[model samples]
Each structure stands twice: as C-alpha cells, then as structure tokens.
Target: MNDSAAPVPIVPVILCGGSGTRLWPRSRKTRPKPFLPLVGESTLFEATLARCDAAAGFAPPVVVTGAAHLDLVEAQLNGCKGAGTIVEPEGKNTAAAIALAALRLPADAIMLVCPSDHYIADVDTFRETARKAADLAARGWLVTFGITPTGPETGFGYIRRGEAIGVASGWRVDRFVEKPDRARAQAFLDDGGYFWNGGLFAFRAGTFLEELAAHRPALAETVARAVRAGHAEGGRFHPDAQAFAAIQSESVDYAVMENTAKAAVVPASMGWSDIGNWQALHEALEKDGSGNSIAGRAELRDCSNVLVQSDGPRVSVIGASNLIVVVDGDEVLVCTPEGAQDVGKLSGASRQ
Candidate 1:
C-alpha cells in the first residue's frame, strides 16, 4: 500500500438538521443555528460546505436536511459546486440521515459525515484529520474523529482511545462514554486517553449500511425502502415521505458505532465547538480586551466575559460579567453563562 499515491476522494455527508433551540430567540424553528452567521461572515452551514471543498480530496457534499429547511439549505448552497441534497420529509436523527446518504452513494464510496452547525477554527487540521479518517475508512474501518480535549467539558460525549490499530494515525476505540458528570469528565482528562466525541465520522457507504443492518435491521430496511421509493427533483433527492416518516429515529452512536467491532478513531486538535449554547457561542467568537463579544447594535462598557447580540434593537450592557444578553425581534434573553443551558427549557414553558 503506497501511502503517497493519490487517495480517493470521500463523499461528504453533511447532516443539516437541528432546531437550535438552545440558542432560542435568535435560533427559532424556521431559522436554525446552522443557517445563522453566529461566528463568521458566512453561515455555519456555508462554512461546512467550504470546509469540504473539492481541493481537499472531497467529493461535493450530500446534505441531509428536512423539508422545512430545504429552501434555506438550497439558498446557502448557491455557488457551491457539485453538491447534492437529500430532503427528508421529517427529521429522524443521524442514523436515518446517514442511511439515506449511504443508500444513495456507491457501495464503495467513502462518506465523511459532519454536523452542519459546528465551529472549527483550524481548517487545515480538520482536513488533515478527515484525510486520516478516510484512510482508515478505505480499509473498511468505521472511523470517527476523536477531538483532543482541551478541557474537562461535560456537555459532550467522550471517546476512550484504546490500543493502536497498527495504522500510522489510528486507534481502536476502547469505549464510548455518554456525557459525564464533572468528576467523571475530569477523570477522563486526567487519564489522558479520552477525546471529545465531535460527531464527525468516516466510513464506506456499504460498510455502514451493512453494520446498520447487522445491528438495527428494522431501521436499515425501512430507510432502504424509503430511498428506493425516493425520487430526484431539482438536484434534491426526496425520500418517500410516508416510508421515511414511519422509520424509527435513532442516533448513529446508538445504532452502529457502539455495536460495531470495527470502530476506529483518529485523534486531532482542531478547535472544534458544537456551539451548543450561548456560552459556547461566546467562547468560539472573538472577544475584546474586556472579554466581551458584541454583535449587531450592541455596546458594552466595563464588561468582562459577556456576550451581547441584538438583531432588532440596540443592546447596551454595562458593568456585567459572565452574562449572555440577546435581543431578537420581540424576544429578549438575559442570563448568566451558567444559566444558558436552561434557555431551551423556556421554550417548553412558553408553549405551556
């Protein structure tokens, strides 16, 4: 195996679903986090497309998103070359989304799965990691990128890297741990084998489908039926609404990765952040000398570790630290960084 040979390009499977409810007010049902330009000039979704451009040994991405976001997804992909989209009738989580992509692509095609709403500050490292993951995938390994943990963060799941797989830059996954308590998270960091599960994966289309069939036959069969009954329209593949809607929803971590023996991980540090909440968004963005991030019509005075974003009004924050203030349309949210996690719970209460 000559490692210096031109490697095959992997198909990018961009999962474009998510309500972004955690960053409520700004992130609404109609306009989710991926479509918002939270950190940079381009929307996160656009940034994702750019990240997997053709020059990086990647095929044009296959975006899996719900019908509700079809227009927005298409709009963002305006100038993107060679990209295809699969429009789901309803959201069925990552398992179904990846199945749809796998079923559409050639069996031997390698798929690079990524969530649409993550922020990666280092593009070069990200591409290098993906390339390594693709190398493992080419050899029939179900590969997931294990982000080197910079801190003991409890919000994301952790992956324990086991013995090396005899590859240059790959390892067998010891185990997948769910989001842990603060104590457990610190233990993982101290033990130095665990990496943050960034939800990025690489595998051959046929390999993943086979593993899915072996682990969750019902889901695999149902999604296959839906894809078979699907049709292409205006560059978008539409899975049969009725059949897809009936398929059971599950995450890939639950359906395949945990159950498969071929699971491998490529560890890398690329400044990844899910941007799950306002606090995370604050941390990902650039901050002023006073440690404040202000967007739109916002003014901060004597503020440290504060984030203020206003889309509809002039927001002024003074003498505040460790706070998140957002004003969008008729809604306003003001909370400490610690309380940002509870913001999504407000959505349910408002409906009640």
Candidate 2:
C-alpha cells in the first residue's frame, strides 16, 4: 500500500443544462443561470472552469451542454482552453450527459462531473476536496463530494457515510437518501453521519462507463453508438441527434451511483450552493448590515432578509422582509423566500 501525491490531471465534465426558471426573470430560457454573472463579476460557468484550471492535476474541461446553448457556452469560454464540447441534441438528464463525456475521454482518465450553475465561494477548499475525490477515484471508487451541511437543508439530498475505506480519507457510501422533510432533515443533522449530496462527482472514465453499462445496458449501448457516430464541429462533439433522442433520460444518481457497489464520498466544506432558486442565490451573495442583498440599481428601506435584483429599470423595496423581488427586461417577480420553489412552475403559466 503505497501512498503518494502524484500530479494526475482530472478531466472536468461540466453539465450545462437546466432553464433555472426558479431563478426566473433573470434566469430565462434564452440566457439561463450559468451564462449570467449571478454571484460575482464572472459567470458561475467561468468560475467552475477557473476552479479546475491548475498547473497540475487538472486537464482542460469537457463541457456537456445542449445544442441550443452552444453559442452561449462558447461565448462564455473567456479564453479558457477545453478538451472539447459534447453537445447533446436534447436534455437527457445527467446519466447520458456524463456517459458522453466518459466515452470522449481516455478510459483511465479521471473525470470530475460538476454542474455549471453552482456557486462555490471557497475555491481553495473546493480544490482540496477535488484532490481527495481524485485519490479515491484512482483507487477505483466512484466518488461524490458530500458537502458539509450548514443547516437542516431540505432542498438538497443527503448521503449517509459508511465505514472509512482503508487508509483513504474517503468513506463508502452507506446509502443515498432523497430530499427529506424538515423533521427528517433536522434528524439527519443530529445524527451527524449525513452530508449534503452536492452533485459533484469524480470517477475514472472507464469506471463510470462500466457501472453505467452494467446498470443501463440499452442506454449505454445507444449512447455509445451515438458517440461512435458523433461528429465534431469547431471543437465541439455533437452526439448523433436521432440516437441520443432514442435513449431514456435519467440522472447519474438514479442510473449509477445509487446502484453501484463502488460508491464513495469525500466530505467537504467549500461554501457550496447549487443556487437552485433566488433564495439560494441570495444566500450565496454578499449581504448588507440589514441582511438585505441588493444587486444592480436597487434601493431598500426598512428591509431585512430581502433580495432585490434588476437588469432593466430600478427596483425599490420598502418595509419588506423575507421577500425576493427581481426585474429582468419585461418581467418582474415578487415572491417570498418560501415561494421561490414555485417560480419554475410559473414560467409555464406565463407562457399560457
């Protein structure tokens, strides 16, 4: 058992889908959350790229995004070099998206699958977590980063940690649990062995495809055929449209992680957030003394725990608490933090 810290480059597989409607008005179909500079000056996607760009231990990223957002994705590259883009004909969830990336890389290459829209404030801690996961990946364990839970967060799923795997800092995944109710979430926090499933994963390309094929044979076969027939256009690999459409859609958690025996987790405290809604985005952003987060031209008076964002026209909130107000182009949204989850559903109502 030799323990060594060798420099091994990990290929980043960025999943760039989702309309992010819960972040509505600002995160629209035309320009979704990843493309927008939501948190800081640079967009979340660009930040993700920067996180994985190291002198050693990280190769250029292989971004997996929809064909429709190809131009947007390319524009945001910001001079960052990449392995290439794997353009999906349509959204087929993460399982297939990851499979496309796994097929593109060398079998032994370690791939770090990250969602483009997530916000990680502490880049140093995140890189450390990636190194830990990579170590586990090199040892043939499929690794998922278990974010140290900040609170009883019901919005995210949880992973139960099992026994430590030999001398490695990683632990075997005892079980994968779905998002729970408030009481259950609190119980999980009290139990102390559970970590928030941040959806960040690391695995060798061959290991991931092997497990994916073992569980989803037809999907594996179809995606492989799609990859084999795929064509490259301007540094982007376009999977066979018809073939990709034929495969069933499923997330990596459902198709592989939940079922694989090699599932492992590396607990990390990286100040991470998926930014699934405006409330999440608000939490990730800097707040004033009054606990109010104001972005762009916004004025606030007697407000606490409030978030205001505007891209066109000025936004003003007075005598409000726990409210989210956003203005983007022709759309304006006003909702409580509790009501943020339903914003995605509102997009359809607006269309109707």
Candidate 3:
C-alpha cells in the first residue's frame, strides 16, 4: 500500500429489508430476492458486500433486515467478520430501516446506505464514485448516486441535477420527480438532464438523524426510542418491536432527501439495475442472439426476448416473444414481460 492518508471509512449500511414482490415465485418469503443469485453466481446480497470490501475503503457493513429473514442474512454472510446485523421486528420501509443502522454507528460515521438487491455491473466505477459520495457526505451533504438513465424507464423516479458544487464535487439536486408516464419519461430523457434515482445514498450518521428530526421528528424520536430499548445478542441487535412498529412506514426519499437542502448527486453510468422484476433481470443477464437468457436447463425454439430461470427441472418454451418463465422447485411463474410487474400479487408469492 502507498504511504498516504487512508480514505474515510464509509460504513455501508446495507438495507436488506425488501419483499421484492415483483420478483416473486423465485423470490419468496423464505428466501427473498437478495439472497438468490439472480444476475450472477453469487447472490445479490453477497455481491453487495463485495462491492464495499475493505479495499474499497468501506467499513464493516451493518445489515438492517426483518426478523423473518435473519437466518438467511446470517447464512449468506458467509464469514464476513466484523459485520453486524440488526433485526427489525416487522417491515417498516426504508426510513425506519436506515434509521436503525444510523443509530448504531458513531454520530460522525459516514453511512453509505444501499439497497440489498440491486445489481451494479461496474464494481470499480462504483467504488470510485462511492468514495466521492462519502467525501461529500463528510462535508454535510446528503449525497445520492444519480444513475445515468439508459432509457425512458417510467418504472423509476428521476432526479434533476443542477449546478456543480465543490471542485468536481457533484451537482446540486435541482428537484426530484415522481415516476411519470411513458410520454413524460421520454420528455425527461429527451431533455438530457435527468437521472434515475437508484436509491443509493451517503450521509453522516448524525447528519441523517438531524435532517430526519427536522423533517420527520416523530419518526426520528420513535426510532431512537426503539434503539434505546432494544437489546443485542451476539452479532444481532433486536430493536424494540412495539416501538418500531408504531413508526409510520415511509421511504427515506420522502422523509429526507426530497426535503433537505443538502441534497447532492453524483452521476454514474455504472451498469446499475434495481432488478425489480423479471423483465429487468432478463435485461441484466447475458442473452443469446435470439434474446433469450437461461439460468438453469431451458430449451427454447422460435423465441424472442424470453427469460427462463429454473432452479429445478428444465423449462421449455416455443414460439414465445417477450416472456418470463420461472421455476423454483416449489413454485412456477409464467408471464409476459409487461405482466411481470404484478408477479407479487399472486398468492404463491407470499408462501414459503
């Protein structure tokens, strides 16, 4: 290692608390989406940890997850020494989930909040930009990674970037726009100044709480109380269930980022994907000339843009276009790419 001042150690507060409803059948209550290897050999959760290794200037991760998924979290940790897991009694959305992690670290600790199941193809680019975000966070900026939009994707919210701040320090977030219709999304894309909000963020632990207290005081206070009353056993910390459950379910985006004056964004084209549904996963995975990607044994004939993921028996498709078929030993799901968004609504998605 070169003899130089080490970079700030960013504590990666990995928010591992999503049902991944849209990715169901394969993603279920027992082994949600993050724990499954949807994109690559290692699971999305494992890939997330690798992205913030010590070499990348990240501190040990603090994983905030629901109690139901604690076993999966621990099993998948696979000896990531020094990592800590915080178990929430129930699902309370991102705001409370992140607050749980923030409360456990030092007030000055820089927290790099990340969603557990997203796929980032360029790890090097991610690390470089992550450090930049951390520097901005250290300077009291609430930084979010602004992913360069590749298309007019109405499925995600967009971030409007403004004047550059600091020396190569990222741009001021002009405003955040909610998910728009296809036409509006296309208009935003054509304007050439918007980016997809990938839900990745960086801010000091204390800075975050201060803003939360300012914008959502009730939530801030309740989370704090939950932490104070909570207890820890070994590597897992259990927050006061009743106190945590009392807090309203809201995303950090609404609770702070959209309300804070310190919001900044680092634009990155790091091959990012939320892997939100079957269609998105198909796009992320490698495809044959016919536009078909298969994870397990699958045979397709005269198929165009088909995705087949089977963890059990071989799947076969013929004369299909823009389709998604999934088979996970216990369940089977089939739908058109457009119909993929409602996969979670199926009764089987909730089953173990």
The best candidate in terms of lDDT: 1
RMSD of each: 2.0, 1.8, 3.1
TM-score of each: 0.96, 0.96, 0.95
lDDT (C-alpha, whole model) for all candidates = 0.91, 0.89, 0.90
Top-down lDDT ranking: 1, 3, 2
Candidate 2 lDDT, tens digit per residue, 1-352? 1245354678888999888778888877778889989999999898888898856468989999997788888888865665588899999999999999999888889899999999999999898889889888977889999999989999999999999998888899999999999999999999999999999999989999999999999999999999999898878899998898898999999999999999999999989999999899999999999899988798899999999888868988889999999888778889999999889889442452
Q: In model 2, which residue pairs have backbone atoms overlapping below 3 Å?
A: none
What's the lDDT for residue 163 in model 2? Answer: 96
- Stretches > 4 Å off in candidate 1: 1-6, 348-352
lDDT of 1 by residue, 245-315 (tens): 88999999999999999999999799999999999999999988988888989878888999989886898
How close to the true structure is residue 196 of candidate 3, measured as C-alpha lDDT? 96
The clash number for model 3 is 0
Mark the 10 consecutive residues where model 3 has the least summed lDDT: 1-10
lDDT of 3 by residue, 1-352 (tens): 1113234689999988677778887777667889988887899999999999877668999999888888889898987979999999998889998899999999889999989999999999998889888888888889999999999998999999999885855999999999999999999999998999999999889899999999999999999999999999999999998898899899999999999999999988899999999999999999999899988899999999999988879888999999889887767888998899888788777654
lDDT of model number 3: 0.90
